[model samples]
Target: MNKAENIIVGISIGDLNGIGGEIVLKTFEDERILDFCTPVIFASIKSMSFLKTHFKSTINFHSINSINQVASGKVNVFNCWKEPVNIDFGKEDTKIGEFAIKSLASVTKALKNGDVDVLVTAPINKHNIQSEEFNFPGHTDYLAQELEGESLMFMVTDTLRVGLLTDHVPVKDISKHITSELIEKKINTVYNSLLKDFKIGRPKIAVLGINPHTGDSGVIGTEDDDVLRPTLKKIKDTGKLVYGPYAADSFFGSNNYKNFDAIIASYHDQGLIPFKTLSFGQGVNYTAGLNKVRTSPDHGTAYEIAGKGEADENSFKEALYTAIQIFKNRCDYEEITSNQLKKAPRIERKQRPN
Candidate 1:
C-alpha cells in the first residue's frame, strides 16, 4: 500500500472515566496524526462528548458503525457502546471497566481482520478492571492471546529501548521466570524486531542481570551466572551482537545502555525504573513480536488530575509517532529482505566455483 493511501489506526479508548478520552481528543487536535494515517477510535459517542466538553477541544468527531465507514483526513470513531452513562471523572467503576474491555476487543478484532494497519491503546486501570471477564493481567497478555503470538513489552524513547523478561510479576517470583529459554526467546524477538520493525541492522543488545553486580561472580546470586550467562552465550553463537547480564545497579550509571540498541531486563521494575526516569512523560510502551503494530503511552491513567486539563499529552503523541515510524520501517525492511532473497541464489553460485 502507498504511504498516502490512508493507513487506518484502530484506537481502543482505555477507561471512560479517566484521561483516555481526554488524551484521545487532545492528541488528534493536531492535524499531523491525520497526515500520517486515519485514526479510528473504538469508543462511545457519549464518552467522546464528555471529553470534548471537559477538555474544551474544538476537534471534530465523526462516529461510524463499521470499519468501512472510516474517512481519511477526519477523526473517525467506531461507537462500541451507544448508551449514555454517568461519568465520574477520576473515579473507577465496574461499568467503565466493561466499556474499556469492549473497546479493546473491537479494535483487536479489526486488527486481526486486516481492517486496520495498527492499534494504539490508551491506558487502562489494572486494579479496577481485575475480574473474571477481564482475566488477563493487562493489554500485553490480552493481545498475546488474541493475536496468538509470544509478545514482549518494551518501553521506548528516542535514545533507549528496554524490554522486560517478566512484566507485572511479583518481585520475589521474577527469578523463577528467568529461564535460559525465555531469555533466549526474548533476545531473538528483540533482535528480529530491531532489524524488521526498527530497521536496525546488526543491533547490539544489553542483557541486565537479576542480581546486583551481575552476581559478583556468584557473590550476590547464581541466576546471573547459571541462567543469564548461558543464554547470552547461545545468542552470541548465532553471530548476533548480543551482550551482557550487566550488573543491573550499575548498567544505567556507567552509560552502558547507550552502547546497545536495546536492553533486556530480568523484570519489569528493573527496566521500567530506568526508562521512566529517563523519559517518564515522553516514553512509549510498544508491544514487540506481534504481527500488527501496537503502542500506548508508557504512563498509566492519572485519575488524580483527570478533568483538570492538567494531563500531559506528550507521551500519547510520541506513541502515535512511534507507531507510524515502525509501520514505515517494517515496509522498508520487507522490501529489502525480499530483494535480497531473490538475488541470493546468484550470489551463492558466484561463491561456489571459480
Candidate 2:
C-alpha cells in the first residue's frame, strides 16, 4: 500500500545455529537496498550483535526495542528477546528454535495487524522449529492458518514458476490427497494468483501428471487417468487457460515449462527437484493465495555452511524483492478492479407498451 521504497518489510531471524542470520545480514549489508524498502528484523540486538561479531560484518544496525521505533533507510533490529542467546553454528538445538519462534510469531502478528506491509522470512529449521506453540510443517502451513485464504507453495524465479498440489504430504499419501475438488481448488488458487499477484492477464497454466508417464495411460496407476484428466477438463471448460497431466519427467527437461505462465506439480519433489535444479541459488519460495504477502529464499538453514561467512545472499535478496513487488501488485490490482467496477456503465430498462 505504501510507496515501493517506503513499504515496510517485517523479517524473522530464523534458526540461530544455521545460516539464516548470515544471509539476512548479508542481504542488507548494502545500504542502498534500504532505498527499495524499510526492513525490520525481529530479533534481539544481543543475538544480532553476536552474529555480527562472528561473521566479522561491518554493517551497522539501527537497534530498536519495538516496531514503532523502526525507521526507514536503515536496518532496524527489534528486540524480540532482551536476553542473549548461545549460538553454536551447524548445531541443531531446540532452545535456539524457541528464539526463532519468538521472531516469527512477533513478525507474523505485525503482518496481521498491518504493522508491516510484507514479510520476507529467513530459513528456519523445519525440525527444530517444531513444538506445541508452532507445530506446522513449515512457514507456508503456519501462515496459512494465521492468514486468510488458502496457501500454495509457489516456487519461482523471474522466468519460471512452479506450485505444488501436496507440499508436505508423504509420497504414499499423495494420491489420496489429489482429488477432483483439490485439483480445482489448487488450480484456481494458482490461476488467480497469476492474475493478481504476478500481473499476468489471460495466464496460461500447465499441470504435471501425478504418476510416471501419466500412469502409462492407466498402466502404472489410474489416478491421473480418472481424477486429474476429468478435473482438468472441467477447469478448461470453464474458460480457464489450464492444461495438462503432462509427463513430469520431461516437462522441465525439454524446457516445455517455458511455454506456460505457471506449472502445477502433483506433489512436492516432483516440482521442487527440477525448480532447484534450474534455479537453486536464485529461487524464492512464495506463499501465494494468501491475503498477506510472504516469501523466503529457496535454500534452507544450510547448517553445513553456518557461521562460515560463505553464504550467498542472492536468494534472500530475491525473496525481499519478490515480496515487495507482490505487495505492490496486489494493491494495484485491487485498485484497478475496484475502479472498473465503479466506472462500469449501468443498464436501464425502458417501458415498451406503456
Candidate 3:
C-alpha cells in the first residue's frame, strides 16, 4: 500500500434530487474515512446545505473557490455552481441534470490535471442529464470521451470482479458490437489492469458466451462458436491465462466464477445481473483502463428513497476504499516493475547455469 500522504479523492455529487448528497454526507460521517485520504466534493453549498437539513448529519462543509484550498482530513467543497438549487427529493428535474454535469466536468478536469488521485462519482440520472452538453449514455462514455482511453466498466466486490464488453447498449445491438478485435482489446485491458493496478501476475480470466449453453455446438446460436471461441483461442495463443465461452446461465450457477480473477460478459446485463444479484448494495462499479482511477457505487440514484435517510452508504464506502487500494497497488506495481527491469540482465545471467 502506498504511504498515506493525504491522497486527495475528488467526488462528484450526482443528481441532488436523488440520494447522492445524502449518501456522501453519511459516508463521510465516519472520521476513519479521513485517515487514508482527503475527500473533496465538487458540489454547491446549497445542495450540501439541503442534505444537512434533510439527513440531519452534522458534517463540516469547508467551501473552496478553487482546488488550491484543499486540505487533508478536511471535507473541502469546491462550489461548481453559484446558483441556489431547490431540490425536490425523489423528483426528476432537468436543472438537477445540468448541475450534475457541471460537477462531473469540474472533477474530471481536476483528475486530468493530477490535482486528484482518484474520482468517486455518485449516481446520475441518465434521462434527466440528456441535454445538448451531456449526450453520452452515462459517466463511462463521458469519461471515455474526455480521457480517450478504453473505458471498461467492471463491478467489484470482495469476492468477484465482472467486466462488460458492451455497456449501456440495447440488447439487440449487443452482438453487432462484439467483434473479435473488441473482445481481444477488452480482455487485454482486463489482463493488464489486473497486473498493473491489482498487482496480480498472470491473472486468470473467464469469458462468457453470448448464447445459451455456449450455442450448444451451433444448435442455438453461431455467435459463441463463430465469434467468442475464435477470440478466446487467439487470446490463449498469446500465452495469457484465459478460458471462456462458458454458458452464461450455468457459469454463475455452478460457482465457476470463483476460479477466475475476472469474468468478461457479452453485454451489460449478462455481467451486471449476476454481479448485482450477488453483490447488490455492496458492489463498486469501477472504470478500468483509464489513466486515473474512477469508481462509483454499483446501484443507481434510487429516486424513490432519496432524502429519506434510507440510502445505504455501504457501496459508496466500498467504492472509496477500492479506489484507494487500486491506486496503491498500481503505484507499488510500477515501483516493483521498474526495479525488476533494472536487474533483469544480471538475474538472467545467474540463472543461465553459470
Q: Give the candidate number with the greatest TM-score.
A: 2
**Cα lDDT listed for each candidate:** 0.87, 0.93, 0.90
Q: Mind sharing the TM-score for model 1?
A: 0.95
Per-candidate count of clashing residue pairs (backbone under 3 Å): 0, 0, 0
Q: What residue pairs are clashing in model 2?
A: none
Write model 1 residue lDDT over 191-240, tens digit each, in one string: 98899878887899998889988888888889988888988998899899
Better of 2 and 3 by TM-score: 2
lDDT of 3 by residue, 204-322 (tens): 99999998888899999799889989889988999999998888998998999999999999898999999999999999999999888999999889999997889999999999999
Tens-place lDDT digits, model 2, residues 25-103? 8888888888878999999988998898888887788999868888998889988898779899999999999999999
- Best by the lDDT measure: 2
Q: Which parts of model 1 have CA positions greater than 4 angstroms off?
A: 1-4, 346-354
TM-score per model over all chains:
0.95, 0.97, 0.95
**Model 3 has how many clashing residue pairs?**
0
Worst 10 residues of 2 by lDDT: 1-10
